[model samples]
Target: MKDLSYACSKFPAVSDPTADEVRRLRAEEKLSVRQIRARTGLGRNRVHELLRGVPPPEWTRRPNAKDGLRAEAVELRGQGCSVNDIAQRLGVANSTAYQWIRHLPLDADEETAARRRAHSKVMTDARWAAHRAARDEAQAATHRAAAGVVGALTERDLLLLGAAIYWCEGSKSKPWRRQDHVQFVNSDARLLGLFLRFLETCGVDRNMPTYRMSIHESADVAAAEQWWVHTLQLPATRFQRPTLKRHRPTIRYNTQEEYHGCLVIDVPRSRELYWRIEGLVAGLGAAIT
Candidate 1:
């Protein structure tokens, strides 16, 4: 590299370029500040100050109307005009408007600020309570609606529905000790009936095996089994024993109580049937969408 001092001495410095010219050259030619400084032999700081369109440090400083406009910007922010809107009204950039308004409080007086904060707290509380109430009501409505439809399924219907539910959602395969026995495990007795109806639709034999119940460890396992046996008119010998999973505090087992657990249905020839059912589901989705 050439000695910068010698280069500066060789080229006598002219008046600094105008800010408009600097910006235009930077945009059109994509020249760096260092490149401009090297070519003109101007000091790096001087080049930067010129590029920014600010006066050099030697120039006297004075607060002007622009400072007053910043105060107006703060007032407008308190009134809820967004930074972009304020910038447009003041003929300044959005970033400059934001910088002016960021430190100012939303309310000018202590009383007004406190009142606004209190109102915000009340509104937040109301919203949360309303949300929780709505969620509970919706869950109750679902339970009621499910109850109405679940009581009418016959034993054959239950078996077929259970089979279909298993085929769609359960883990099953011939290689994995062929789960040929049909079992419908659910905490909700009503939903169990619906699942059994779905099984009947799929043509599963009702007499092949009796429906069994399984629930979370926290639930009344024996009571749940008895409910299933009595509701379905199955003999005690036909009722398979219920399995209870241990409860963990961190584990979210909402489905264990509410949703019917995976139904183990007897599908003696399930490989081809599984694919057919999958294709039917895919076709239905495509048709509906």
Candidate 2:
């Protein structure tokens, strides 16, 4: 037997200050990885190597949001959830979910496996249903909040809104040709009403618009005409002959009871109105720029 004390005395153990500080920070001071990194100016990889076999303090282990998610994943795994099941329930990626609960063994017989699958299916369906309900509620809440923001529309607001819509949906005079007059067409009844209100706001109360219907030839044209006349309180004689669109079987069009096709509103001597809308639109563009 060699005397280890005599050999050790000949070759003395060297004291490492970096290792000593790392150990002191980890053991005595109980500093977190981030704190130790800042204090010692050590790279993350070096710190991790130094931290081997030393479990982090309980505060570090539990306080993180990711740790909370991992805990939830472990709980779900215990309840017989697979990796995909955990991903769906936690709104996490399947890969991330797998890493969280990989150590947990799924010990089950064939019967238990089948039972787990059925439970997973039921839970998946329930999760989707709940998600849809929550999404609808969030959408409705956002809509109501936005509607509340617009308590009342002044004339200026209507002018701006009307100009934008007309630019989008109405006839605009092209440089190659001319749109000539202010003409708007749309299938949305509420939109048509808003345009009319916009016209009234612009003091075009006397120029009663001649309504035109552009309906599918296959549709009952008379029924749609009568509905539009009654709905818009239009004088029966003011409505022009409807332009029929030839139906194609390849492209399916709405043939529901509520389908009224589209309405075309033409104003007489609306050259001034056209220019006004153009100016408003141009002003809007300039204001944004």
> How high is each candidate's TM-score?
0.35, 0.53
**Model 1 over residues 190-272: C-alpha lDDT tens digits?**
55556555544666445544545545667666655555557654456655655566777776646443443322333344455
Query: Judged by TM-score, which candidate is best?
Result: 2
Report lDDT (CA) for all predictions.
Answer: 0.62, 0.88
> Positional deviation of 154 in candidate 2, in angstroms?
0.8
Flag regions of model 2 displaced more than 4 Å: 1-131, 251-253
Residue 153 CA error for candidate 2 (Å)? Answer: 1.2
Error of 2 at 210 (Å): 1.0
What TM-score number comes out for model 1?
0.35
Q: Name the regions of candidate 1 deviating beyond 4 angstroms.
A: 1-166, 174-191, 198-205, 230-234, 251-289
Per-residue C-alpha lDDT of model 2 across residues 1-289, encoded as one tens digit per residue: 7668987889999998897798789888889999999999999999998888887876676656688889999999999788988999999999999999999866557787788779989998897998889999999999999989988889999999999999999998999997768999999988887888889899876247788999999889999999987777667787899999997877665888898989999888899999999999999999999
